[model samples]
Target chain A: MIERTATIASTVGLHARPASIFAEAAGAIDAEVTIARAGDPVDEAVDADSMLALMSLGVEHGEVVVLRTGDDTAGEALDALVTILETNHDA
Target chain B: MHSFVGVGVFRGRVIGPVRHMPPALAEPPVGERLEGSTAPETAAAALKSAGATVKELLQERASRAEGAGKEVLEATALMATDPMLIKAAIKLVNTGTSAERAIWEAGEAVADTLKGLGGYMAERSHDVLDVRSRIVAVLRGVPAPEIPDFAEPFILVAEDLAPADTATLDPSKVIALVTAGGGPQSHTAIIARNLGLPAVVAAAGVTGIADGTQVFVDGATGVVSTDPGAAEHAAVAEWQEKASLLSVFDGSGRLADGTLIPLLANVGGAKDAQEAAAANAQGVGLLRTEFCFLGNSTEPGHADQVAAYKGVFDAFPGKKVVVRTLDAGADKPLPFLTDATEPNPALGVRGYRTDLTTPGVLARQLAAIADAAASSSAEVWVMAPMVSTAAEAADFAALCTAAGLRVPGVMVEVPSAALTARHILDHVEFASLGTNDLTQYAMAADRQLGPLAALNDPWQPAVLALVQATVEGAVSQVKHSASLETTSPKPVGVCGEAAADPALAVVLAGLGVSTLSMTQRALPAVAAVLRTVTLPQARALADRAVAAASAAEARELVRAGLPALAELGL
Candidate 1:
């Protein structure tokens, strides 16, 4: 598996619209993606496609989080998800 | 009809069946485990199907929704179909837990986990609970515990409503709001004001009233009548007819004899200005400039203040825009402007006094207002709040002159300012009575404290006497006034919550207030009531008010003279 980390850019953190948008994007990708707080162990990661799991991560704005994908060709998917996390939806 | 009296925050009357927000569902009992007739697989299938059904229902609603509420429904729909939910339920069912118990336990586990995460996640716990309740209700063939899906409008009676509860409500469906407990500034009242629903708060025993009980709610009088007698039915019909007219403002503010009193709006920012413009406010009477300095750690730059003011100015081109300078300190303390704490902020360094410690702040804002005025078509008139002495008014007027703004004024919130209005108006152009502060200061009551709300009323004899003094003083200086473009000494106007009252508006007009600036919703009603009485009658009403022994007595006295008020249920 491969991974990437990016800071959440939404003013209210990865909440409401930002979280929903991120989760929907992760679900559309053909990989089994997982996310966790940057300092937490990879074993503690949750499904990136699940809104509940994404929210339960408590990823606040400007806080860094880790994104990982098990699929080989999905290395690009993690990068794109990182882009969503970095873009400020509120702005 | 039995009448329950409370504080009315909005205007109008409506009769509708009250809808109680559903009580929370009972916890599903820890019934027997999946055995015999109810197989574990069958239990698991039931939970999954319930989830699918709920998800489909929410998905359909979400598809038609918009904005933050739409996002809420969409997120909830995703939670309903969450695979983790069913997997956990199936695991519990396999462990011999009953289907109902498994679903409840699985939902609780997820909700508890979300709550534990806190912050944004904690709030999402509600979404889980919402979905959980929906799934359970679907399985049990019962309605979900939430706001109803009634076909017609209603009077939403509740003990109180949370922000979440109100978000799902369709404004059109709620004819009025009756709450058992809340103040004028409560969340329920704010929502009612935003929805333009006539509302009564602090209403006792309203929640006990059953659903589908037809009730008469007169928002102006704060009377919620359960019995719809023949006379009450006629009153409702009259209210509907007059209220329909009150909803459409002609943009002209005058008495029956055509004495003009420019009705204006009190706005905080550009958004409010846009709404006021749409509501056809004569112009902005009080442009509160606190939005900038309140949020910033330091004073906002001249350019930023200019840009902010320009948005409001753009909305009311070629109209009178009375802009009050930044009213910092007091209840609204800015770190850069005033001390962080005070023994008595109500009496401490506030309003125009904030400029004493930080001299350049007011100067910077005045220059910015002039800068913005230069670029826009609005007739920008600047005023300073809390001017206690004639020297302060003169000082403020000089500052306005230096900034190149033509019209300068001082708010008569301070009793001293109202008492010395003639001396102040000699230097300044006009005086606008901020009756909220005027009443609070005159009565020595903290306006924020709920218990002291009675003394803070504008109808207080002492408060009316002060308003009378301010107007008389301004009138005495009418012709000799340096700012006199017209001979009309209606120069002393009102721009407070008191000015919004229809009964009080007539009194202010009678007392010779030139303009009445209030919330836009009050404009049509005030105009409607003002049209009922000629200038001489309004003057007679003001006389009755001033002669009354107490505030309640004063209100009743003035309300009696204007039978049109009772006719329109003002």
Candidate 2:
């Protein structure tokens, strides 16, 4: 599995437009992607492809979150989602 | 004809066939477990297909919307197709719940989570509920919910209408609206009046009126008379003809004797300013500043306030723009500014009272208004809300002037200020009567209480007496401030729902009010009715209304006094 940590860059966090954008990106990749707030228990991890799950995480700007994927092409999927979560979509 | 009465939102008469709104869809049935293992798979497919249909529907709506409406619809669309919601629903179905029930439960679960987050995230619960309803309809093989459109004019009958339901309504096709539910202050009522549609809100048996039944709606009297005969039809036609004739008398309101009454618009922000301008509002009477304070955890900085105020001021260059400072208090408790747990926040610390305790907020806001005024050509006037004493009025005026604002005024919404209007007016240059709150305070009725609606009528004798006192005080005080040769009464305006009423506008004028500010849609009718009477007749009506024993009696007396207005605006 490939794992990476990224700071939420959207001023409004992973909700509204940013949540939709991140979820869409993750949904497009062929992988079982999961996300959780940094230091959260493994059971707290939610499917990255689900807009509701991403938004329910209540990730705010500058907050750190972890993304993990079991697929071989995890690098491409993580890069796309990390780029989405790291950019201020609202701005 | 059978008649039903409720509160009228505007003055006008409309004759049209009834068109009832479709009822809200039922909730998914509970406890219907999946029949077999394959039931989960079938439910998953249903969920996906339903989500696609909803997404498509929202996409179509978003494409047609503009500005904020477009943003809201697009955001809702994204929620409709959220993969997490679908996966959650599928999981619930796998747990032996019916597909429809699973979708409903999963949507509620996520919505509850968002609601618990509070603030902006909590607001997203509405979007989640809206998306869930759409998906549930698809699963049930029912058509998606929408406000119906017609090829011809019809009276819209509904239990109640949400903002989205009414936003896209075709004004030309909807002649008038009669709702079985909703009060005078409901958003549906406000929008109907804003759109110039005669509306009767809280009319019992509104939904019971047969479809396509011809009805005569008198928005002035809040009377919906069904199955009208020839005589009623003729009266309606005559009123309509007169209304069309008076449509030519637009612009500044005036008395039959040519007394000028500046009709200004009460606007919320830039968008409302634009609408007011389009409706030929002479100036903005009440530019509410609440929009700036809403949705902010901390008080907005002077620059943010300046930018927002400038947007409104720029819309009405060279026109009078009276802006009220943050009216926040008990009801709209700002976490950063107010005590959320304060008992009786309305009566305790609100309006100007809050500002006195929390000086920084008021000071910054005044500075912002001053900046906005310097940058725009509109004649900016600043006012304080909930001023109960002459000293408070003087302090607010001094603070406003210190910040470089020229026209300083105070809102006469409290009984003490209204009772001693001359004393209060002596401290400020202008006074705007907020009749809604004045009625509330005078009658000791909570404006939010539906059962106490009778005491909250602007036509209540006590309420009218207070208004009369304020107007007379303004006239005397303005004359007191000016030279002996300049005998014009100090400019007193009515900026409330009462000012929008044609009959009440005349009474206000009779009581010496100089300007009238209301929603733009009510301006034309008010202007039309004002022209039908001389200054003396208006005073007579005011005297009659104020002398009546009760609100109902006062209204009846005024209606009897101005019988011509029944068909004059038509």
Best prediction by TM-score:
2
- With candidate 1 superimposed using the best TM-score fit, by how many Å does residue B222's alpha carbon deviate from the native? 4.3
lDDT of 1: 0.83
* Predictions in order: chain A TM-score: 0.94, 0.94
TM-score of chain B of each: 0.71, 0.82
- Each prediction's TM-score versus the true structure: 0.65, 0.84
Clash pairs of candidate 1?
A: A13-A61, B490-B514
- Writing each residue's lDDT as its tens digit, candidate 1 over B423-512 gives 998888888999878988898986655556567678988888898899889777776666547686637879988888889999998888
Worst 10 residues of 1 chain A by lDDT: A50-59
RMSD of 2: 4.2
| lDDT accuracy of residue B195 in candidate 2 | 84
lDDT of 2 by residue, B386-487 (tens): 999999998998898788887889999999988888888777778999987888788888765545666767888998888888877867676667457657
